[model samples]
Target chain A: MALTIAIHSYKGGSGKTSFAINLASAYASVGKSVCLLDVDLKAPSSFNYLLPEAKHWVNDIFEGRYGVMDVVKDVSKEMGTKGAFYVGYSNPDIVAVRGISSKDRKWQSKALKLLMTAKRDLSNAGIDIVILDTGAGVDFTSVNAIAVADYVISVGRPGASRQRLMEQVIGGVYMPLDKDCYIIENMCHNDNPTDLSGKKFDLPVLASIPCMCDVAVRCDNEVLVLTEPDHAFSKKIYDIMESLDKITS
Target chain B: MTDNSSTEEMIRLLREISGKLDRILIQGSADNESDDGILDVLDVMTLLTLPDHLRTTATALFELGSATADELAERTNKERAVESNYLNQLVRMGHVAKNRKGRKVYFSIGEGLGK
Candidate 1:
């Protein structure tokens, strides 16, 4: 069975998208067929990194103009992966973003159904995992991604306020949906300690990655997990994957 | 297409689904063996016909296969009474079947929702 994971956050600037991309890269490097979807339609930055070229974007799939297969692009050769790495990028144009964001509840409801169908299609294509890079907050897009996911990894910074926001979302959304949720304390400073124990939150803290100034400042779409496997940040990413395997298994 | 056109399209689809659901219910009512109202097989499109609140409940039930309201409550993080009402609503819609096994009431997809 293909496991669908949604990397989500209650707020932005928490390294959610980067973690999602690297997590997908890590799995592909290990010969697991993975499909990373840039479902954060309003702020699609995956295109800046993956630089995928396709005739159809993910926006086309939701609009009933095309299906998942029509937009899926394989970059296994480019990424030098033993397994296939496919991506379904969303259109990053301002007009496209506004259009998708302005969609009504009816359209969003239909979009959710389309997403479920897309999940099945990806699984049928032999994908081992499907990772959704979701937008922050309780928007329609985020909820749809959460609804279809088997697991959700919520990324947050180390702070009392951020922790409170994380707790509210977990209690209000993840708990209600009965999702398997894990927390990643991203960009933790030396002075600000992240509670690794599960008592801090209802879910387990998957990892507490410290602030690497050189890495945190780099604006490039460099996937350190694949390029620099020996790096401390990369090791933490792998550790997170190991923890996920144990829990899921 | 504009929002107006999209809204119109959604209405059209809902009408089509409603017609299909009506036919399924009537045929199921006639074919039911145990005299337990309409017993039918819901397909994937059934998800689209449900409202957001009911959709969430139905989705959880679909994942659980068959469960009591209390079991569904635990999974959905809703009160058992709320889940019971939702399950009853699904039963009325012929999308789910209700059974009494001992003292507990179990609700399951009518036949199967295409897995």
Candidate 2:
């Protein structure tokens, strides 16, 4: 089976989705079978960035209208890269998000189980890595997704308030999870992690990625790692990919 | 419902899923999922449940990625005679694959419903 990874954060706008896509691309570049799931059911972003015309979304997976395999879009050919690369999108329509995450206890549990089955089914299809770009902050779907994951890479920004919030989350929310959890401080002014780390947060900071216009400009449309594998931002992302490869399978 | 042992296995599968769902509620964290219970609903059940022998064999094979009959026998805790029959039936059912090397055979999960 494959290792499940959740790109999560306690704060919004931490670039978790961007990191997840690039990391997935990096893994696929190495001939590893990978799938990037846009499971942020509350607010979908990957479709806007990668495939705006996606017909099947993660919403269909939750609605039980489609199996995980049915909705999987093979992005490897579009990526113009090697290995198997797939993307499962989430419905960007307001109605879909409302229905998926609305106040219905029964529906929520069933939906969570379906998502778990989705990952399991994907692994059954010989995918070596499954990465979920979950919603920011503590949400039911995010927690359930993380619970089923084997490894978690929590992304955060470099700020006093965000740092404090993360410290609380790492202990309160993320600590109890019995999985290999790591942190990434994104949007750093410089590459120096020690300087950006500031106060000692009680979590393993895996990579400190700098803010680059190169990334921000292309993120709206193209994937930086796929388009420019030798860019500065792409190098840092590879550094993260290499670092994760060592710790995780 | 099919047989006495099969009924017990169905119950076990339900309890396994129900208990896992309960953990989300038990944790009671901000993001922890809450549910009344699986016992209350009839239609909302997810996590496609399989028959007793099929589930034990299929889940073990899918989870382990691949296994030989002997290895699967240990995983599902069945006698060699019984387990071998189960594996062969699964292969014939198109739920599993049988790879042969000399006299040894390795079994892997195949494209079966809910597998």
Candidate 3:
């Protein structure tokens, strides 16, 4: 089975989706077959970021117009990488179903089945890494994504509220799954301390990303770190990805 | 000499009507596609209900997440002229706040907008 990593945050503006997309691009840059899923159904930004180069109809997959494999588009070229990259789109109705009920066992089961189907399809296409960009906050969907993940990268900013929320999310919900979890501090400034060595959180800090203007400008159109490789921000992203590899491997 | 039960019933009826209005506003849909125009006007009318910075930041944050300053800059090739034009629009609309985190200037959706 491919390694599945869910990039999640308890609060919005934490760059969870950006992290997931960059991580997938980074993994693919190293020749790994990668797949990314935008689980933030209400605000599906990945498709907009990865479109033009992205193939495989999202609506087709959701409407049964095409199998999951048929919708797996190649986004590696856009990232300037050699591996294959595909983005999975969520159906609004399914998202509504998941959001509408926490106690609906059937909905949960069906959602899991859909995820598994997606995994199987990607695996068949030789994907080695699966990254899910989960919705912000400790919602039912976020919890479900965490539960199913083999590894969870909790992205957060530097603040007490963010930390407290992270603690609540991990301690109260995800910790029970026993999955390896890492914290990534985004939008870090030069004045801010690094390593978060003694910051006192439930998880260890895997990476601290400095705020990069180039990156902010690029959005999700392409991988900033890969494109700029030598820029300070990109270097940090690369270093973080390397550390993540050590932890996951 | 009004009965208490009748008064309570009247209050309940008003509450139901108010609840319906709230739903309509939240949903932003109805036979009045033009209702959107009216809602915009109402939002402007109630602009005093919130602080100017708060309104600006709220709009900025949503727009930022839907996209981002860095992404916008990249689309325009990091040209200050183009970037300023876009950023100015955000600033004017109160959807983004300008902040300097170091040498790099960052525009984020105003404060307390993160869900």
**Residue clash pairs of candidate 1:** none
Q: Order of candidates by lDDT, top first?
A: 1, 2, 3
For model 3, residues A1-249, the per-residue Cα lDDT tens digits are 778888988788887777777777778877888888776655565545454444544444433467767776676665567778777665445554454444333333234435555666666667788898888886545665665577888888877656767777776555545568888899887665434456554368887787766676685666665676777766776788788778777
- TM-score of chain B as predicted in candidate 3: 0.33
Name the fnat for model 2.
0.03
Cα shift from native, residue A232, model 3 (Å): 1.7
lDDT of 1 by residue, A62-97 (tens): 887888988888888887877898988888899999
Which scores greater on lDDT, model 1 or model 2?
1
User: A144, model 1: CA deviation in Å?
Assistant: 0.6
Q: For residues A161-194, could you state the per-residue lDDT of candidate 2 as single tens digits?
A: 7777877666655555435778888888653333
Model 2 spans > 4 angstroms off = A190-201, B1-115
TM-score of each: 0.72, 0.67, 0.60
Instruction: Grade the docking of candidate 1.
Output: incorrect
lDDT of 2 at B114: 26
lDDT of candidate 3 over B1-115, digit per residue (tens):
4699899999999999999999988677544444323232212112223444343333333323333455555543465455556665655654445777667666653322221
Best by DockQ: 1
RMSD of each: 12.8, 14.5, 21.4
Better of 1 and 2 by DockQ: 1
